[model samples]
Target: MSFAPEELLACALARLIVARPTAHVAVGAASPVPAAACWLAVKRGAPIRLSLLHKRSGNPFTEGSRELFDLTGQGRVDLFFLGGGQIDGQANLNLIGTGEWPGREVRFPGSFGSAFMYMMAGRTILFREEHSPRVLVERVAHVSAPGVSEPGVFRRGHAQALVTGKCVFAFDPARGRFILESVHPGETVESVRAATGFGFDVAAGVGETPAPTEGELALLRGPVRDEMLETYPEFCGRVFGRRAAA
Candidate 1:
């Protein structure tokens, strides 16, 4: 059977998570769609250091979100994944306003602690489900979080690997440039170009991203899915309604 977009995205994210080196913890925000899906990599038996941020002390969780920030501050987190409303060739992301600003053409959800996480994390993984000229642009409207303000420092700390509907890319360390590393199944260089708004470097003889393995599917259908249902029962209830119980 063919995999749906969500399943394709889930598998791709799972693969990316598996590729990351181990760390003490992995912190994802309230919107855990990507995080939950990617957790399958760990489920599939890929080694990873991960834990969910349920809530704060005295509020209701085993550990607080502060741990994530503190760990990153000390350079403990090895990898993280983030979605963006807009991205550039430099991998500088924008999750804030879209148009002229304040009361302009379009407005978007403000940056959700992206500034701190992007600045302090050891490595960042960026993915965009919708790949189109408007979503991937030459430059962002504003720097929601500074990627490389004065060059050397921020640039070195910020190593971004971007995955989109059509292709996968990693920023070149030398110039902090985004270079196409691989194309997804059935995707071509031309298709990637047509989807993106800016120019990006493509590696010579780039290959297709490997498909997800059986192990990954089991992980998604097992512990990971159950945990999400239990941990976010209210959210799940909203999606599936009261019928979720049956």
Candidate 2:
């Protein structure tokens, strides 16, 4: 059966979530892809506690991100999703914009709690669909969040993986670099290299990313889509052909 790119990405992310011992997953307000992946993992019986910050109803927090921050500080949030206007090989995020302090050239959404969440969360999965030299850079103009801390610093966790449109990269906190794990269909190592600005190591015998299984496709098209309809109606309609009621 055919599946949209979003569904494929969600399935990939679900696999990553279930691959590890994830007890709780938190998705940010602008992250529809991670939210869908969290729901898919639950539907697949991963026993993961999902916290959708943008849920229209039954939101877990009462006073916005304050409670979320509190939980993250207490190490209750196991996995979180983060993205930036620019990400470097070291996984440092640049949400401050491009050029100059405070990004006088190209302004992006200011970083609110990314540094805290990145340091305190058990692990982070960086997701950015647009994979280009502009988005993936050699170095971020500003460090909104440092992917790896120096010795003697207290860091709860680091980025586990970065999912892009072209491939999946496994991050190595020890070396502070990315390793190409798999290339998506229709992409090759050369293509990914051409698109990326930073250098990375390639996994030996790198292979294609596995397509969504039949079971995964069923859940995404059915229950997963249902759960996302309210929070991500436009995404559901565009990718799953299900529209929310007016």
Index of the highest-TM-score prediction: 2
lDDT of 2: 0.90
Every model: Cα RMSD to truth: 3.8, 2.0
Cα lDDT tens digits for candidate 1, 1-246: 344444556676666666656553354653454556546766666666665665332332344557677767788776766667788877777888677764165676777767877777777778786789888888988667654556465422565677777878877645768888888888988899888988888888788877656665556555666656765566445433333344
- TM-scores of all models? 0.81, 0.96
Q: Compose the digit string of candidate 2's lDDT tens values, residues 67-184.
A: 9999999999999999999999999998899878899899998887898999999999999999999999999999999999998989999999999999999999999999999998
**lDDT of every predicted structure (CA atoms):** 0.67, 0.90
lDDT of residue 74 for candidate 2:
96
CA lDDT of 242 in candidate 1?
37
TM-score of 2: 0.96
